[model samples]
Target: MAALRQMQTEFNNVANRLVAQWRLEDGDAWAVIVAAAVAMLLWLTPHA
Candidate 1:
């Protein structure tokens, strides 16, 4: 009961901080680079 509530609050606080940090960073170029890397890896790797 009380433990569950405490866990939920802590989770919310951690999630909010992560969201704030993510929002503060430059995400556009990072997203494009990540996508390109993933595509390259997929293209180069043998089918499994």
Candidate 2:
């Protein structure tokens, strides 16, 4: 539990830093995240 909490905290800190550095608006950050997730899913999907 403690390890998970620490990792979550670290992730939050890094995300905050990235958002500030990139000067991204809230919607832009979410859009970037969703786009990355979709790209990753497409990349991992097996070709038929």
Candidate 3:
């Protein structure tokens, strides 16, 4: 669909810009994100 194509194009543009600016390895970025998410989850969990 036209809408989906437009959304994809916009996403690609933003991602490209970020990739250019950040200059970080994609794998390293994802690892850091996952680690932060897990730490937040642990902090929020109620203990018995």
Give per-residue CA lDDT, model 2, range 1-48, as digits (tens): 676567557766766666776674778876775676576557646631
Worst 10 residues of 1 by lDDT: 39-48
Best by TM-score: 2
Off by over 4 Å in 3: 24-48
Candidate 3 whole-model C-alpha lDDT, 0 to 1:
0.60
Per-candidate count of clashing residue pairs (backbone under 3 Å): 0, 0, 0
Write the candidate numbers in order of decreasing TM-score. Answer: 2, 3, 1
Listing every candidate in turn, what is its Cα RMSD in Å to the true structure after a full C-alpha superposition?
Answer: 11.6, 6.8, 9.7
TM-score of 2: 0.52
Stretches of candidate 2 exceeding 4 Å from the true structure: 24-28, 33-48
- TM-score quality measure for candidate 3: 0.49
Cα lDDT of model 1 by residue, 1-48, tens digit: 676567557756665565566775647545654675577557646732
Q: What's model 3's lDDT at 37?
A: 53
> Could you tell me which residue pairs clash in candidate 3?
none
TM-score of each: 0.49, 0.52, 0.49
